[model samples]
Target: MSARWAADLALGVRLALGGGGARTAWARLALTATGVGLGVVVLLSASSLPHMLAARADRSAARLPVAEAAGGVDPVFAAGRDDEFRGRGLQGYLVQPTGPHPPAAPGVDRLPGPGEAVLSPALAALLQSPEGALLRPRFSQRVIGTIGDTGLTGPNELYFYVGAADVAGQPMAQPVRGFGGEPARRGLDPLEVLLVVLGATTCLVPVFVFVVASTRLAAAARDRRLAAVRLVGADRAQVRRIAAGEALLGAFAGLVAGAGLFLLVRVLVPRITVSAFRGGIFAADVVPDWRLGGPVLLALPVLACAAAVFALRKVVIEPLGVVRRGTRVRRKLWWRLLPLAAGGALVIGRLGTEDARDPFVIAGVVLILVAVPVVLPWLVERVAGLLGGGSPAWLLAVRRLQLDSATAARLVSGIAVVLAGSIALQGVYARAEGDRPPPGNVRVLATAFATGVDGARAFTTALHALPGLAGVPVTTHALLQNAAGEKFSLAVQTCAELAVAGCRDGDVYTSDRLAPGAGLWSGGADRTRPPQWTIPVAGHHVTAQEGAALIVTPGALSTAPGLALSVNATIPAAGPDVVEQVRNLIGWHGRVSSLGTERDDTSALITRVLSVGSVLVLLFAAGSLLIAAWEQLRERRSTLAALMANGVGRGVLARSLQWQLAIPVAVAAVVAVLAGLGLDWLLLTLLVHRPMVADPVAIGILTATAAAAVLLVTAVTLPALWRTASLAHLREE
Candidate 1:
């Protein structure tokens, strides 16, 4: 053991300063540092996200105050609290007031007797008051008091606070009452999930960086007079220990750099958001938690060492003479390219057929990711050959990509992943950009109101007369229970009977167990408690028991008892010209909304997210590309030196080097486009199981962008490549 340790230590000391191993060690450290820094950034960000989410959830839950309830209350209420509050819950209150001025808005000067409640900030804002006070209407002395924010009873609503007592007298839950449904109650926040995904992905970087550097260094050591060590009684194990130890040292240095970067990002996120809620810098508090940090710190080094150890085994088993020539994957090119083709097909098909705006974009991203490794080698070879034209230095530099396909693949793989992620995100954003509202939606919403039947007919007449207008009115309605358990109005539009062209379906469906067109009356086993009523909506009916109703058309509702119906028109294909004409014809009598508005909003949000995500991906990709280029240049330095000795000009050599990098990037871009199509197809499949309705224009744009990226990368590397190819000083050295 002592002999082995001494031998390993000596090798380790020599590797730290000897020939190429010394440079390789430093290079490995640099590469690992980048990866570790990314990992740490992702780690801190991801950890804080979940902690922040939980904290926010807890805070919001606390503010509700109903979790404090201890004794028996309504069975439903008790059941709801069971999950959130393990022990005693908050006391629930119901205060009904009989006072003079019923609560109109916030802040009222002394109601008749018991004061009013401060319900929600939204209510306060709506009422144009400060404290949400209500003067009991027609009653001499009675009032309810309350606090906190609650949301109105509706889909996609903001939070508002409402007390049972505050709305006890109202016919329905004060316009917005939801005791059971809230956004908070939904699983985890999506943003938190995104952070986790980022962290998990970044963790693999150090492993790759360490493995590649170690492999290269180990190969070099054999040729540089280190081969006799094993013959001189130094076993493979000792050699491996030395190599792995060097990797460990590099990993530790990287960890420090990574930790510092994580801290910086942590500080930045809060400043960007600027709110009362400060996210955990390390998880749930100001102080760092080892439960999270320990895992990170320990995991990074372990991953690095494990990667090094695995690569070291390859270094050990091989005979020194052959291994000195360098390692290679003895596989056919066709075998590799086949996977690339399959992946490309999937990616291209997806990008071609699906809505770029769908979450399915992520799937397309994955396909592109899978295809990259298969395509990279050939791409590098082709690009390098092209760059090698007429330039000896560039020709030599280009051989690095040609002769060592695996190394090139390794170097380029990171860039491929980065590019895939960015393009997928960008596709999402671009589609969104086309759909963004023209600043008119928000302003128009305030002036517009749902139209009555006659009002709709009148508006439709004017709309049809408008220039560029060509569509019939599409109006639908729904019967839904109000917060106070009273059935009232609900409605939506079905423009052109197409889902995407600005048409939404109301949430009204027949209960499969119940018969169609059956009226719900309070009675039998399932029907005993306000038995639901099923009514015919249009030609095709929805089953809604008496109390539980479904959607209907404005025309259909006209026949229903005590039902006042309204009509709305939708122009799915309408443009600015038609919109303006319709506006003039309608003369401000009814509300006008373009389906485009919603699409535009969705697009804007998608763009923001894609932009941020793409930037990070680009950074990672660029770094990988640079590392690959640098290593390639270094590995083939001798070849370039020979060319310099042969009187090959540095300029030509640089061009060749540029071509090598450029060609592979271009090839990857092409493969990416093909993969993008598969991505589009996958999305289209999700939209409709049958044949796709592909967007040719979108395909064209995607292809163009990918091609452009390849060109851009090539342009950026040309000058530096030329300089590297010029072996004037290298030859002398």
Candidate 2:
């Protein structure tokens, strides 16, 4: 506020704007600005993802309002079925409304009448193909129109609206309401929550690393400059102001660049469509709201300035010079391990607990992630101390790390976190997939509802003729009264085929009679012997006691007149193509209501998201490492040049740079691997009782990737190091 203070602040501002600096100093400042700018760009882009997805979802929902608005309304006519077409699944609905139709949507000009269907573009394309002939007969309707986008179908899914008569059977039950005209806004479900968390983790972790690395760029040069000001009698407060000013300069520039980048990216994002979503996000949605974006843009400079001032805390600035004040107290090794221990304990305690919330699990994961950076510096220091004297390059590298192990560790911290995540996810994915049978090998169950015995028999015969079907078991339903006069529905399968076709249990003919006092009768010794005729109950007796007992008997079809027949067939290869074929053939005789395959689509989706997250993390880590390495080389230019002038070979200098980068990364990688394994073990115990299978190939690849990233970064700095060690650099120093 005083005149002198005002002058000092102005001087600091000028200095930040390159009032007195070498060309290289300005270049380093530019690099720092660029890094910060890109970090902000990435942050904004990631933040906009949720909005973009929502916009697309809204667009889809708007097109299917009739389906959306059907809640609580009884349908005049309705029929729906799920079947596979070619290699894709298809969901078809047939409706004839007695009341007013829904308002026209974006995709459909008008509703289809009898014998006509409106299909999604994807379905329309399929029907126009040669293979569409196989699928056309089932619908038995001409395609009248195409839907552009609708919530009733996924980007990759097939959906159609047809006349009521197009479906094979009369409505079995009232049609479930579709999403009404209003877009159904819902909070994130469990799976979606996991996706958002992982997505944020992947995007933000890199930004954090970039921010830290950028603030540290040319730190030594900045330190020396600040030390000169202290030597000239500037107080600590003044020194802090100068450093803050310098940081703010770069941060503000970065903020402007970031905003520009966001706009530029928004221009291109609308053109890019993700197959996972089956569409591109609207460009307007990708724009960040200024109410939120404004604060974020302003906060970066503030944080950068704070980081700069914080870095100066350990220095003792005297009128004579500045030196780092050594501390008598050392950070205890055990203190670094506390977070890891606490996190591991939390995970172990919570595993398989009934009331465990997802937030609790995510918190545990956070603690584990935090512990890596916390403990890494200490580990690096200890490992560097253990390495004995060797080549000059090795000694120089080891000594440098021992002097400031934290900085060395910080350089590779991003990769350490990424590696940890990738390894843990790999273990979880492997264990999840291992517990299930391979897709091609698992069996599929298809159930058909037929009107009578003849139709069921025909369906069974057709199922037997299908290429992949193993067996067709047909059963007849009838109401049978027990001696107690309690009636239950009985499903009768042939006694001769019971051994191989129906329930393989030898007690198939045994009576499970319900008693008045006791809950249910286990077969009595007297009833164990095969009788002239036996009834086998198949479902829950308590529920069955309310109705007729479901009995499986050989003579039910012959004796029980007018009974409905159902046939179930097992197919060995339950691929979409095979399932579609089976559905088509069975449709000729009966309504095929339910078809289920062994494949876990949820697991597949999780795997895909994990893969994308892993790739993003790798890119972020690699970028941070590259920036940090270049900065380090620039900071050590004087020392490297002096060493070269004294006859230290360039090769030794190059090797020293590699060693400095490698030792800390290797330590971090080992810790990461252990942390990853521990996390995976805890997750598996919570989710399933599966063996911990370490995928060696995945582990090896992750380890190799870490090493490759370090190597590549080190290589990038070698040419710069070579120039820094030249005579010109020495003279300038």
lDDT of 1 by residue, 428-470 (tens): 3333343344644322221122223444445556555666444
How many collisions per candidate? Answer: 70, 17
Residue-wise C-alpha lDDT for candidate 2, range 347-446, written one tens digit per residue: 6666675222466666667777778877888888889878989999999999898778878988888888888877876776666566665545435566
Q: Please list the C-alpha lDDT of all candidates, in the order they appear.
A: 0.43, 0.64
Q: Give the TM-score of candidate 2.
A: 0.70
What TM-score, over all chains together, does every model reach? 0.52, 0.70
